[model samples]
Target: MKARFEELDFQQTPMGELMLRRRTEVGTGTDIYEVKLGEEFLMSSLFTVAEEQMATLGLAAAAGDELDVLVGGLGLGYTAVTALGDPRVRSLEVIDALGVVIGWHQRKLLPVSPALVEDPRTRLRRDDFFAVVRQAPAADAPRYDVILLDVDHSPRHTLAPSHADLYTAPGLTALAEHLNDGGVFTLWSDDAPDEDFHATLASVFADTQAHVVDFDNHLTGGTSSNTVYVGIRQ
Candidate 1:
């Protein structure tokens, strides 16, 4: 018999209704967690290989012993936790637009929440990632060695309409200002590799590459792919 799912937490944000749920897999008897925004599925514990890879790949491309990282989304805390795993990462600032998502980590509701909260090197900041990137850096602002973003569904598809501009060349240029010299910028997309988005990145950054991350989709019983775009600042 298929195990039943339980709603762990739910909240209403400016974006939409947010919910966190968990269920046990019937065959494996392992808990599967999911986050949803309204009727749209945001993330699932069943497939986190791409999310974890976003951090590992981004950090590897960034050259530095003492690295300061910036993560644009805190979904399930997988990327944030993965970044903290690196001994070279001196600090990680995770920025999320939704406060409820941050609360999920602070309350230790998500599976990766415990590790994220207990890590002193990680700091969760509630702010609009696009706005933060678009604004001029303050005198005390700290430029990151690498900036990993996984907020939008894709460059063409976004959770919010306002996020579409962030994928553009001009918007990407603004975000590049937040990175140090030779810094890396990585973005995770639910869709497959998009050449148009790659062109946009290439126009703004010195070097750009798109990586296809494939993982098993339990729901479909087949392999599914996501794209990770990596750009390096000069």
Candidate 2:
């Protein structure tokens, strides 16, 4: 049997101290992969229902057979891999601010890294998602059919102060500008449904909704829920 706990990789990133670790549960004997940013827990392979759902729900609402998708975060490669699973997606670009995070995938350090790196439709770009959307797209830029954002914890709870603006009305409007007609915007939030954020999405998009996704929590012995907010541009 493998060791009880093993640190896979560690790096000092601009965002903070990034670390990946694998631990085998004593009872289940399942190896669980986890990511840590500084001292706070960021993501875990054990629970990624909402991250996968962000892509599934977004692409399901998209109105095209061939879709150009944009993913605003690439944590453990769950969201990006899920998006690529759909045959309707023609292209996918994932934007992440931390180069070290991207390096983990490029080096095939994570389980889903192989799928994300081998896919022809996927492009992992090292850049700030908020910064990219905050600026106007170039004249020749192709508008995205669906945009999946899984950066911050929620609209109000952000990893950094700079990310808070993207959850606002003006920031959402800028995000909408990058989408094609009938395009969809999906966001994964750790918080429960936020009425204020829903209202802000409604102000910027033609339609909006908050979907609560439930997943089994091994540690808690009960199911936990995450909110996925969808907005459609007309």
Candidate 3:
């Protein structure tokens, strides 16, 4: 099974020990993939409906309030790039825990997305996502109007157990602290949400809703169901 480019096998990730590879076909570059635990499919560049929707919904919920945005994950840089496409966005802070992923985007992966990787309004931060949220200032002015998270497959089933904190009571409070008045938060999960995650959102925001979107993934030649949860800070 040969594609235009070869899979670049690398280190293990928190989700599982995995290899990174690029997919190309018909002399055109496709996207990248992370093969987890040698069998489970992780993320790929082929389908990005959920990633794009996360940003789109977040911005719409913000209702022109978000000048600066903080995206919790930098997967394929889709959400970050999509948010940056908006002229109203003054700044973007993209936080990812894995420095290697960032390195790949800066080096091996930039050719596929030159414009997004080199955007002037973007700031890439290498740190644990929750820590960044916790450190956010309590002051009103500097808060992020929108917070978009695409870091995990779902709240119930996470790649990292430590991430559960982000869906907990204290975590919800921390996230709320960083949100400006009437701001919005969007979370993307590969699958449906569990009851606890749903309740957690209800506990955190004034309004909450689950949105389902269809995805046509080009890499695997399959259709997948993706869901997003939206929370508005009252």
Q: TM-score winner among the candidates?
A: 2
Q: Per-residue lDDT of 35-113 in model 1, one digit per residue for the tens?
A: 9989988899989999999999999899979999999999999999999999999999999999989998999988889
Would you list the clashing residue pairs of candidate 1?
none
Listed in order, each prediction's TM-score against the native is 0.97, 0.98, 0.85
Question: What digit string (tens of lDDT, one per residue) describes model 3 on residues 1-234?
Answer: 566566665767665566677666564554445444468677776667788888988887886733889999886777888898788898898898877667777774544346666788788788998776766575554688899998878887776777888888678778888888888889999886566778888998999988888877655788777888999999
Candidate 1: deviation at residue 65, Å? 0.4
TM-score of 3: 0.85
Kindly report which residue stretches of model 3 are placed more than 4 angstroms away from their true locations once superposed.
1-5, 12-18, 25-39, 108-112, 135-141, 193-195, 217-222
Give lDDT for model 2: 0.93
Cα RMSD (angstroms) for every candidate in the order listed: 1.6, 0.9, 3.2
Global fold similarity of model 1 (TM-score): 0.97
At residue 12, give the lDDT of candidate 3.
72
| TM-score ranking, best first | 2, 1, 3
